[model samples]
Target: MKNILVTGAAGFIGSNLVLELFKEGPYHIIGIDNMNDYYDVSIKEWRLEEIEKNIKKNKWTFIKGNIADKTLIEKIFEEYKPSIVVNLAAQAGVRYSITNPDAYIESNIIGFNNILEACRHSYDDGNNGVEHLIYASSSSVYGSNKKVPYSTDDKVDNPISLYAATKKSNELMAHAYSKLYNIPSTGLRFFTVYGPAGRPDMAYFGFTNKLIKGETIEIFNYGNCKRDFTYIDDIVDGIIRVIKKAPEKKIGGDGLPIPPYALYNIGNSKPENLLDFVSILQEELIRAEVLPSDYDFEAHKKLVPMQAGDVPITYADTSALERDFGFKPSTDLRTGLRKFAEWYKEFYIDGKR
Candidate 1:
């Protein structure tokens, strides 16, 4: 059985990917996470429990650790000798980067460099090493770009947020490593991903929490922003398809490797207005009985000016993804929100069993 190493295993995307991988085959999966209190430690623990509950026992292993520790990461890579490494364990959240820039630097920069270093050394002495490295790149990398349908070909030099800057740095670093080491790498720039058991810091989850408590929810930029909100299942599906293939390794005209590196945008391709997204979310919450049907959503919403490190819009050009992978994120907003609302009612409202 092939060994797959997933960093940030307890995170929203990390946990989901782990569960889905078990369904794929008898592959042995190794997962590691720091289990930080960035949002809620309980939620991360719950995700781990869910993975254990769903997957076949003995096929998977979970290690509680941080990837920023170079020694720890090197140890994991040496022991597992993973054929595929999925690095999703970065410090998330654009706003959080403003106050806590250190976290981003430590995890997003240092941690990723450690992973790349491990991958580079994996091929030492003619031993077969990590065949492909898939890491999470965020839509935030396209910060402040006025271009609609942000393409992989677009230049993303101006990052409005430190979080975005870190992600862009990841892409560049990966490309450099790929060229030098001939490591097949793919970076996925995910759009606004939302679903059940997602990050509480995300807009949808935060809005749900605030609405349930009868607190006002702020709509940034007066709800004028548009986001290509891709659902979690769709994101997982896109990732699964990506895992089966690696970029072709080839020598360039200069007799050097052309860099076996690739990047793709995973998004719904349908950018939804922020105001409309909230409306649908409210309806879903009421439908799921998380909120009363008579709940005054309008009274609970407050439009606010744009905050620091925030972009007015994020649109993705997924044509390259469709062309290569023959798939794209297609989960509609209502269906995804409904699932989240139902989950919230069960996990938070009823009882977190």
Candidate 2:
């Protein structure tokens, strides 16, 4: 059985990916997460509990530690010797990075460097180690582009937020490592991932909470934004397909290793208008009994100007992903939001199981 190491395993995407990986594998998984209270620590613990319930204790190993800890990360590499490493442990949230920039530097930048160093050393002494290194990138990397459907080929030099800058830095770091040590790396630029048990800091979940509490919810950009909302299941499916395939490690005539690195946009190709998305969310909330049908939806919403670190629109061009993997995220906004609503009712209202 191949050993797989997944960092940030308690996170929304990480936990979902872990559960999906469990469905078809004789593989052993080593999951590590710092469990920082960026949003709510209880939710992270709840995700871990769910993972514990599904897989056998022996088949999976859980490590509650920070990836920025170089000694600890190196020890994990030595002990586990994972053939596949998926780095998802990064400080999330574009807005949070504005106020708490140090957190992003320590976690996203330092933590990623530790992962790269560990992967570099894993190949010591002719060891067939770390066949694939997959890390998470963000749609925020495409900052304030006038173009619709952002592609991987588009130049992403201009980043509006520190979070976007760090994500772009990760791609450059991976490229350097790939060229130096022949590491096969694939970076996935996710576009507005939302689903059941998602990040509470996100708009959909926060909007649900605010609407239920009888509070006014601020709609940024005067509800004139657009987002390519991708479902959690579709994200997991893309990650799984990417994990099985590694980039072709080739060499050039000048004795330099042609970096076996690739990047893809994993997102629902359709970008929905912000106003239309809120409408669908409101309908789902009422359908799931999280909000009353007669609730004054018009009064609770307050449209405001765009925030400092947020973009007006995010549209993904997944043509390259489709051509390479023969897959595309097809989950509609309403269906995905419906599932999130049902999950919210089950988790927050019905005693949370």
Candidate 3:
């Protein structure tokens, strides 16, 4: 059985990915999360509870800790001896980085350095060392680029936010470690990921919450923004595929490189306008019976100027993902929103009608 360690296991994407891994068979999983109150601690706790309920065997282990602690991280790698390590624990939100820039530096930069160091030394155990190190990057790295349908080949030199800078730093750090220690690492630049149990800070979830409370939903950029929203299941599938296929060492005429590294964009490849997305979401909410059939969505939506650290549009060119994995996120906006609405109604609404 392959031993895998997943950081930020209580997070939306991380928790969903962990559950999927559990269903795949007998594999040792070391799930860790600090359970920070970035959005809501209850949500993280709830995700953990769901995972606990599904654990028929002792394959899943949960540890409440921060990824920034080098000692704790090193201990996990030493004890668990995970052959596959997935680092998804980072200060998430672009706007949050503005007021809390230090958090980004601590978690995304220093914390990731600790992870790289641990992975580097993990080879001390002759037989039990990480074969692949896959970490989460973000499409935010392409901040405000003039190009449409962002590609991995695009020069991502300009980042508009601290969050994007930290993510880009992670990729660079991973590259350095890969070259120095020969760690086979892959960085996935994820697009706007949304689904059931999504982050409350996200527009989709926030809009739903505000609409339910009869509060005006803030539509940033006067509702002109567009995003390539990728579903949670599709993101997990891409991660799993990349995990199984470690990057190969690029051999040149000079000599074999020290390490192997690769980066790919995982997205739906289709961008949808914010208004269209909200309309679909409103429809789904009504269809799921979470909202009343006569709910006035137009009255609830309030168009506003663009907020700081936000991009106007994000479209992903997933050719690399498709070419390598033969997979892409095909779930339409309505389908994904439907699942989210259904789950929200069952979990949070409590049949409130």
Among all candidates shown, the one with the greatest lDDT:
2
Ranking by lDDT: 2, 1, 3
lDDT (tens digit, per residue) of candidate 2 on 33-123: 9999998888898889898888853378999999999999999999999999999999999999999999999988999999999999999
When 1 and 3 are scored with TM-score, the better candidate is 1
TM value for model 1: 0.98
Question: For model 1, how does the per-residue alpha-carbon lDDT over 205-305 read when each residue is reduced to its tens digit?
Answer: 99999999999999999999999999999999999899999999999999999999999998888899999999999999999999998999889999999
Poorest lDDT segment (10 consecutive residues) of candidate 1 = 54-63
- What is the number of backbone collisions in each predicted candidate, taken in the order shown? 0, 0, 0
Give the runs in model 3 whose Cα sits over 4 Å from its true position: 125-128, 250-252, 256-258, 351-353
Full-model lDDT for every candidate = 0.93, 0.94, 0.90
Point out where model 1 deviates above 4 Å: none
- 2 against 3, candidate with superior lDDT: 2
Give the root-mean-square deviation of each candidate in angstroms. 1.1, 1.2, 1.6
Candidate 2 has its poorest 10 consecutive residues by lDDT at 51-60
Q: For model 2, what is the alpha-carbon lDDT of residue 9? A: 99
Instruction: Show model 2 residue runs off by greater than 4 Å.
Output: 56-58
